[model samples]
Target chain A: MSHPAKHRPLIALVALFGLCLSVPAFAQFDAEAAENTFKDNDCHKCHHATKAKKGPALKKIAAKYKEKKLDEKEAIKHMTAGQKVKLDDGKEEDHKIIDTKDVKVQTNVARWMLSH
Target chain B: MDQRALILGFSMLAFGSAMAADPASIDWGKIPATKLTLFYPGQSSYEWLRSEGHKGASSETARGDSCVSCHDDAKEEQRQGAKILRGNHPLEPTTIAGKKNGHVDLSVQAAFDAKNAYLRYQWKTQNPFPGNEHQYLRFDGKEWKVYGFPKLDKVVQEGKQPGIYEDRMSIIIDDGKVPGFAKQGCWLTCHDGQRDMPKQFTKEEVAANALLTAIKKNDVRKYLPDTRTNPSDWKTGKSVEDIAKLKEAGAFVELIQWRAHRSHAVGMADDGYVLEWRLADAGKDMFSGNADSKTHQPKFMWDEKKVGYKSITADQLRKGDHFLIREQNAVPFDPNAGWKEGDMIPDYVTSREDAKGSAADNNAIANWKDGMWTVVVVRPLGLANSDDKALKAGGVYNVGFAVHDDNITTRGHFVSYVKTLGLGAKADIQAVKLP
Candidate 1:
C-alpha cells in the first residue's frame, strides 16, 4: 500500500499542515498579560506554578480540566463566579472572584492557567 | 428621709466601699459588653501580614491600614479562622485533631473606680472541661523527665506525649505612644523568627545573633519592630541604649496575662511589656518553675495532709485542681516518699507573697462553670512605673486581645484586631466611671 514517490511528498506536506492547524490556540495566548492579571488579583497567594499552597498548583488544575475534556470556558467561569470550592485542607470557602469584567482579559488568563 | 430612701442610701454606701476594694463586686449588668470575635491566627506573623502571600491586602497593610478596615464584616473572623484551622492550610502547617472550633466569642466589659480599672471578660471553652492543667514532671523507672506538652508541640503530634497546657487570656495595651500600634495591633510585636511562626529561628542562628547574645537571650519571643533597624528582620536590632531610650519614652506595649494554672491560684496576672523582647517587669512574677534545674526533680510537692496526694497519676488530669501554691498547699519535695514511676507533679508553682514591685500590680479573679470562663482583671489606675502604661482617667489607648485554649500555646491562640479603649472618654470600649 505504498504511494508513489511524487505523491508521498504531497501527502507528507498535507499531514504537516494538518498537524499545525490541530494545535490548540492556548499555545499562542498572551502569557505575560495573563500573569500580570493573576498577580494583580493576588491569585498567586494560593496558587503556584507546580507547587500547591492554599490552592492547587496550576499544573494540577490544568491536568484536571483536561482529563474532564473541559476547556477555557469552565476556567473562566471559575474565575468570574464566586462559587464554593473545597480546598486541600478539607474546608469549603467561596472562591475569590477575579478583578476584571473584560471577556478578553478573562479568556487570556483562563487559557494561560490551562496551558500550565 | 423616708424609710425606703434610708435603706437605698445605706446600700449605695456599702456598694461603693466594696467596689473600691474588689472589682468582682462591680455591677456588671450596668456595664455594656463589647462583643469581639477572636479567631485562630496560626502562623500568620507580622511578616506574613505584609508579604505578597497575604493577597490583595498586603499593600494596604504596609501603608498602615488597620486589620479591621478590610476584614470588617461580622462573619469575617469566623471565615478566616475556619479556613486556617483546617489541615494543610497555608497558615497552618500542623493541625491538632481534637480542635474543632475556629473562633470564640469574647464578651468584654470595662469600668473604672477611683482606685482601679476593672476589665471583665467571658468566653466559652472549646472543651467541656476547663483547661486548668499545665505541663508536669513525670517519673520514669530511673529519673524524672518532662511530660505533657502543648498540642502543637512535636512530641504531642508524634503521640510520644499527651497534650496538656493551660488556658490564658492576655491583653496588650498601648497608650498612644508606640507608633503604628493603633493600626497594626499585636502583629507589630509578632515577627518572623518567633516560635511557631514563619522562618522560625534555629538554635544556631539564635546563638549567633548579635542582639540575642548581647541580651543573653537563647530564644526569640515577641518584640517590637522599632527595636530593630530593619523592622522585618529579627536579627537587626538596635543598641541596648537605644532600646532604653525607647522605654523611657514609653514606646512599649504592656502585656498582662492571666494564666489558668500559673497565676490564677494566687489571684494575680503576670505583668510584662514587649519592646526588644517580651520582658517581665522590674521585679518577680507570681509564678516560678517548680522543677529544680540541677537535679531535674520537682522542688515542691502537694501537701498530702491537705490535698491527700503527694503526686498525681495520668488519669487524674482535669479531675480537680492540681495547683501547688508555695504558701498554702505545697511542701518540700522529699526523695524517700515511696516514689513511683507513674507519679506526676506540676511544672510551675504559684506564690502571691513572692510577687513584688511592678510585676505584682495586676490582680485577677476567675471562675469556670458550665463550660465558660468569667474573669475580672483589676488594674490600678495612675501607675507611674517606667515598665507600665499609666492607665489614667479620660485616656484612650490602643488595645489588642488574645485567648489561648484547647491545650495549646504560642501561635495556637486566637487573636483580635486592634481596638480603641477609653478610660472615660468615648471610644470603642469605653470605661464608665463608677459612682
Candidate 2:
C-alpha cells in the first residue's frame, strides 16, 4: 500500500510524456531543410545571411517582403516568375528566376535569415 | 592435322579482320578534332595544361603555365598566334591560320547589356557550305544562362565572302525550357548550316558559354572542378604573351565574334590598301611627346602634320639606319607564335618547315612562293627602344616580318583593330600587298 502511493506521481508523469511525443512538432517552416535547399540550388551562391553578392542581400529579404505584406504564396509566385527589378544604375532588369514551388521554403529561409 | 589448321585459321582471321575495318577510321595523320571554344571571363576554371594524354587547350591552363607547350602542333590547322596571313586556298593554303586571344571589354559589355546576347560565326573559307548559325547567351542575376540555340536557317544573305562581317544577335531569355521556372533555363550554341567554324576565342568566352550551357542544360553533374574538358578546370597562362591583355580579364563578354570565310566575293580593291597591324610594344604615356604633341597614339605624336605611321610604327626599323643590323630580328608580335618554330615544332599545316630561328640577318621572311608565310608591317607614332643606345625619343623605326602562316583573317583583324585603335566600328581594311 505504501509503495503504490509513492509510485503514483511518476506513473502519471510518464503518461503525459507519451502524449507529447505522439504529435508532430510544427513551427511553420523548417529552417535547416530550407537552407540546404537554397544552397544546393545555387540560391546561396548569390545570397548570404550577412553578405551580399550579384543579387540583393537575403537577410533583409523577410523584412522587405513583410513590409510589402507578401506571404509565402505571393513570394514564391513572384520568384519563380522574374520581375523587372531596379538595378544599381536604376535600370529595370527583368531577370530573376525561382519558382512558386520554392516559396514556403524561401520565405522560411528569409525569415530565419532576418532573425539570425 | 586439325589442330595445326585451327591455329593457322585463327591467325588468318585476325589479320584479315583488322585489314577490312576502313583505314580512314584511324587518323594516321593525327589531326586535331575541330571544336570551337568560347569562354566567360570570371569563371575560367581550366587549371592544368594536360589531362591524361591529350593536348591543345581552348581554355586557360593552371596557374603560371604557358599556351605554347600543349598547342605545340604548329601544323596549320592547330597553330596558335596571329599575323597578317595570306593564303592561296586548299593546296594553295588560302585559310589564314595564326590564332590569338582577346578579352571582352566591359565598355563593350555595357553596350551589349542593352541588348539580350551576341552571336559569332567563323566560316573556314568563302566557298559557301550550308548551315551556319550564331549562338546567344543570357544573364541571370549572378550567372549567365543560355537561351535555346535558335536554329538560324543558314544566313543566306550573301555578303562579300572574303570581307569580314560582324553583327549583334539579340535572344529571348524566357523561352521556358528550364524545368522549375518560367524564364529559367536558356541556352546558346554556335551552329552554322555547316559545322566547325572554330574560333580561337580567348579561353574566357569559350568557358563562359560552356559554363552557362552546362548550368542550363543541367550538365552540371559532369562539371568536376578539375576536368580540362570544362573551363572551371582550366589553368591560367603564366605568359600568354601573344594573347591580347584585355582577354586576360573579361573583355570577351562585351564583344561580337565573327568568322571570316575567305573572300571569293571581294578581291583586293584600290580604294585603300588594307593592312593588318598588331600593337607590339604598345604603351601609353611611356614617352614624352617628341615635338610637343599631346595625344597618346604612337604615330600622331611623332609626325606633326602626318597622321600615323605612313606605313609602320617608329620602333619597327632595324637598329641601324640601313636595314642591315641583325640586332633587331623580325618576330611577328601580331600573332606572336610566328617566331616559334625550332626543334619544338618543325612544320606548319602547309608543311613548310622552320629549319631554325630565322637567321639574325633575316628580318622579313622572303619565302612566299617556296613556303607558307604572312608578313605584317607596322606604322608606329614614335618609339625609341628603351635600351637601344643609338635611338632618341623621336627616332622612328620601321619593323615588318613574314612569319609562318599566322592564320589571322584579315577581315577579322581589321574589324577588331579598327575598333581598338578608335578608328570607329565600320572599318574597311582590305588586305593589299604594300611595299
TM-score of chain A of each: 0.83, 0.55
In order, the TM-score of chain B in each prediction is 0.95, 0.19
Top-scoring candidate (TM-score)? 1
DockQ for every model comes to 0.03, 0.01
C-alpha lDDT of residue A103 in model 2 = 48
Alpha-carbon runs more than 4 Å astray in model 1:
A1-116, B1-19
Which one wins on DockQ? Answer: 1
**Cα lDDT of model 1 by residue, A16-80, tens digit:** 99998999866668998998788656677667788776578899999999899889989999988
Error of 2 at B156 (Å): 26
Reference contacts reproduced by model 2: 0.00
lDDT tens digits by residue: candidate 2, B1-435: 011233224323422332322212222223211222211111111221233111212222333233222222222111111211223211112232222322111111100011111111121222122111112112222322222221111221122111112122111111112121121101111111101122224445445554334423211211112122333322211123322332332111111111111100011000000001111122221111111133211111112122221112213311111110011111211212222211011000000111111110001101011222111111111212321111112222111111111122121221111111111121111111111
- How much of the true contact map at the interface does candidate 1 reproduce, as a fraction? 0.00
